[model samples]
Target chain A: MAQMKSANVRLEKLNKHYHRVVAVEDVSLAIEPGSMVALLGPSGCGKTTCLRMIAGLVQPSSGEIFINEQRVTRVPVHKRNIGMLFQNYALFPHMTVAENIAFGLDMRGVGKADAGKRVTGALDLVQLGKFSDRFPSQLSGGQQQRVALARALVIEPAMLLLDEPLGALDKGLRESMQVELRALQRRLGLTTVMVTHDQDEALTMADRIVVMRDGRLEQVGGATEIYQKPASRFVATFLGASNLFSGKIETRDGAGALVAVAEGFGLLVDGLSNEAREATVSVRPEAIVVEPLGNGAPRTEVPNSVVATIDQVVYRGFINHYYLKLPGGSEIIAYQQNRTSEGASSFAPGDKVIARWDASSNHVLPNG
Target chain B: MSGRLEGVGAWVLYCVTAAMMIFILAPLLVVMSVSVSDSYFVTFPPQGFTLSWYAKVLQDRDFLDALQLSAVLAFSTTMGSLLLGVPAAFALVRGSFLGQSFLKSLVLSPLVFPALVTGLALLQLLSSFGSGDARLNLLIGHIVVTAPYVVRTVVSSLQLMDINLEEAARTLGASRMKTFWRVTLPQIAPGVAAGSLFAFMVSFDNYPISMWLANSEYSPVPLVLMRQLVNVFDPSVPAMSTIIILLAVVGVLILERLVGLRRAVAI
Candidate 1:
């Protein structure tokens, strides 16, 4: 591993339009050096387009890009000195693993002897030293991905861009490789930007997550911050399952505001002003506590408590999901982790239950 | 009853395949045998299997000159077609512009047009300009017919290639020329080789085109072979045919060794 200069990348209002269709619109962000940030979004959400623009594969329609404070908006892709791993890995089928890894060095006009040594070092870095003689077709999918990773890193690039790096692998391999890739990226101290639609991969690997939707940034924050306090309904639903409640604000308060959903149905929300007339709040499924309402135990009145009937109960291996229907005929899901067999809640469909959460758990999405 | 019909269908398929193979190979086998025959005249079941005709054909001054001329013409035509066809294929497969499809059809129309008519047209077109170079005219005519094969094969190869490989090379610091040499060329070498082999073989044995384009001073092997066949009915003619056939077989085998024949001809 050679010492790499981690670059600070900044996109200044990057916009890409293919005729009338806007691929990416007004995307501006600054990426810190040696940190992994994920552009998380669904397909056709312009995450891949943004990454390609950064890689210089796609030119931005009307914006500038800077790498390490130097403008590169018009720089050609080959001269950018960036390492990119495509979704398909893009290993040259005609070249052996060693030769594939040596391609970048060869392009840079590195001497053959030195290139061979570095290729060996890169192979060992990815733990594929023994398979250097094999072609890409002979390697397994995971092995091919590792070869691609090694090839990208061998160039000692300024930054690394990954487009769905683990999307090709099976579930088990994908999880393991996510951890492995993150560790390798950290060890190299290379600034990396990865584009992935899978939220779990973003959460597990990236230090920051930029949630994108419809060519715009929905939210940008740390994984836990974005998950717990999403800025928009799109972020709340896109990242994970969230129970949403939309209503009109009824009262103003210094600490919290109350939102009225139906007649006599007021939901207390914490940390909000009465500036907006309408508001939408989200609560995580696991954050809500579900208890049997009509049992010998009396139900305690809570700030965000709502008496609902369980519409369905789904038993996932490690957790149980309760789909509850509130009095206003809106459906909400609550997840209860099955820690132990004796402590697992045994609620079935049509069972009367009280679904409640603290005021702090109810996050008001400002622009929802 | 359906099972029996399927069995009969399978038998019919096998019979048809065998008949087709024999139909294709029978004349070739007969010519090969007659080339080695001991008789003065061309005879099949090849009298005593002598190699005298092969030696005698090799000694003929007219055949030697014709062989040299055809060899040079075929080699030059292969090179010319490759030079023109490869870039044309790249343009056809990768470029996007108005009338692209129309241009594609126009480039490939030579394959469907009768070569004899093409030769006649080229003769008229070249003569109208008073282009007196017979060999160059013949070369141009042969290239018009053979370049389409090169373009077609290379186009199929380019189409089947994964585009991401080139992108990866670019991201790996390869310039456009470097990427083409290191990634694109190697990937499509099989198709290029196959196309060149086709051009060489087609140009070497071209009769209809050569019949219109060739003169006494610049006659190619096919014309000389045809003239020999008409003037003298001997094993020497079959011997010369065997040599051409052997050259074609050797070319195919060399191509197969360089890149698998299955891949080369897969298009």
Candidate 2:
């Protein structure tokens, strides 16, 4: 009924070890108030472990967690005043919808009269007011998750933690709920943290994405920034498909660095330091343009142009993917949009094609 | 042609199932009919229907006393088994400790060990301790055998229960004790109900253990029924059996009303 005071959460050098196995290692992060941050990674990469540590469900081996600038690392789960939605949407099977929502209020010592009104309000908030008397088994999966959400929010927690909230839903429902949940979190301005292995989900819903790998933070930034300017080869591949070229830096000047690939082939990357002697550059599939070389195609005077033969053609509804093989026996992929109903017909297998991109599109990553 | 043969095979299976059901029920049917027989001796085809044997058994003081003692013993054994078995189930299912498997085997060993041997061993142990009360001795023996049923059913129920439910309650501001009361107990109620039913019935109809621990002053119904069957040649034995069967049926019906018979027994 009142405005929620969204709190800033901070984790300092969090480490969790189960016996000799490290689950999370020296991870530090500061979440801004009123912004949703998604922990995105593969399974067993410590994203869920990070979320659990913040929820006080899993105690960090050596770390300090602060909520609203108050130390809560040693606090018990119930006293943390945080709401968490599990992946399974753990609704009490014995309690009705209203009873499930009212459980938290009852534990907080809310009186019966007030609790009744709040329970009704929470049900209406999730658009399930009529289903309050029904058991959880009678509701669909989407309805059950909504009831779980309503139960978590009725406590008016300072922060909301979601662990793969839409993982159990069907594809169509998951997409729709993603939009709806993001809108609700924005309206409430609740500082939220969610864990998911779905890259599309993290890209679509989060204000900031924290990519993790091997129990460590890989990259953390806005979705577009991390997607475009990935810091490593793992990020470049994991976020989306990329064509990588490993080379030796031949020239370094005020303009940029020139990387030499195979004999008589070179690539120029913009806005990179001259100190590195070798590097691996990545270019996204959608950024590369493919054209037949003998069709009088006007080519730009860029060092990124390469002659390659089409190895295979994949026809999607709105786009077509061309897998091409270079003279050095390396493979590169390019995506072209289908402007007509027949899809892209400009490239086919065994066709000699020239794939190219601008110097600015190349992202130089460290040679590791 | 194959479809016709398959239909014939299904008919054969159905007939065999029906025959098995009748075979299992025939003994009880004969006893029930003899209990209501108006003849002087127990007969397969009763001449006429009468409730006189039931009336006779109800009026007998020794039969009444044995009935009271059996009911008390069965009721006390159910409570005692629950008190000892539910917590053991929890510890074995949820706790992590050394020799956990060994402890589990120890708790459930009575189910596999012969009940007659358990009774004899208990008799020797109790007499060695200088405790000569027949009621206490019989109670201890009954609990030892019956507790395994409670432990088994409750353990299976605990294993099947979702652990996330408890964690969700804890996150929802419920303490550990409160979470158990509000979440865990309700989910496992059918198993506990089934276990109590088994405990009551086993302790009520027990014979071998009672043979060792029971005295003339504290005799159970099974011993009394055995003595009556050996000495008499009348319908009263069948009548006593009919009463016990009716009590068991009533107990199951009450459990069904409390928490769905299908659910209670499905565990």
Number of the top candidate by TM-score?
1
Estimate TM-scores for all models: 0.94, 0.93
Lowest summed lDDT window (length 10), candidate 2 chain A: A294-303
**lDDT per residue as tens, model 2, A124-209:** 87899999989888899999999999999999998999999999999999999999999889988999999999999999999999
Cα misplacement distance, residue A176 of candidate 1 (Å): 1.4
Candidate 2, B77-148: lDDT as tens digits: 999999999999989988889899899889889888888898899999999999899999988989998999
* B179-233: candidate 1 lDDT, tens digit per residue: 9998999889988988999899989999899899889999999999999999998
A197-253 per-residue lDDT for model 1 (tens digits): 999999999999999988988888999999999999889999899998888887768
The CA lDDT at A172 in model 1 is 99
User: How many backbone collisions does model 1 have?
Assistant: 0
Q: After superposition, how far is residue B39 of candidate 2 from its true place, in Å?
A: 4.0
